[model samples]
Target: DVKVTQSSRYLVKRTGEKVFLECVQDMDHENMFWYRQDPGLGLRLIYFSYDVKMKEKGDIPEGYSVSREKKERFSLILESASTNQTSMYLCASSSPTLLSNQPQHFGDGTRLSIL
Candidate 1:
């Protein structure tokens, strides 16, 4: 089974504090992504890394960044956590399949609250 592990199931940070969310996948997948899910809004991508050190900013990468120095690990960093950023953060991974229909396997999720 493809497994993805996220560091925290729930997190609370003060505004302006730096926050780090760690994710690790054991499926040897080449693509990993970070997303934030909100009530009215669906899953919105933050960042994605195709290779160990190759990353692309997604639609809402303004306040976030990513790092992937190892094949099994990916990290999301919030320069300054804000209350607006409070939401469920999900880490997902998928193999480098040629098909675009490849679904991303997600971690349980980390619910973050910036006070």
Candidate 2:
């Protein structure tokens, strides 16, 4: 089974502090993504990497950045934590096959709070 592991299940930080969230996939998937979910906005992709060291910005990249140093690991960085950044962050990985419609495997997610 494809398993995605996130470094933290929950995190709390003070405003202005830099925060790091991590995710690792066991299946050696070629694609990984980071998203943040809010009450009204729903899940919004922040960044994604299709290959090691190759990343693309998603819908919202401001105040956020990502690093994919290894094929199994992806890291999300909150440049400066703020109250508005508090939300549930999700990490997912996917592999493309000859067949269409590959579904992404997701981690349990990290609930972050910026105080």
lDDT value, candidate 1, whole model: 0.94
**All candidates: CA RMSD in angstroms?**
1.1, 1.6
Candidate 2: 10-residue stretch with minimal lDDT: 95-104
Per-residue error (Å), model 2, residue 20: 0.4
Residue 46's C-alpha lDDT in candidate 1? 95
Query: Which digits, one per residue and each the tens of the lDDT, describe model 2 over residues 1-115?
Result: 9999999999999999999999999998989999999988889999999889999999999999999999999999999999999999999999954244799999999999999
- lDDT per model, in order? 0.94, 0.94
Alpha-carbon error at 40 in model 1, in Å? Answer: 1.2
Tell me the TM-score of model 1.
Answer: 0.96
In candidate 2, which residue ranges exceed 4 Å CA deviation? 97-100
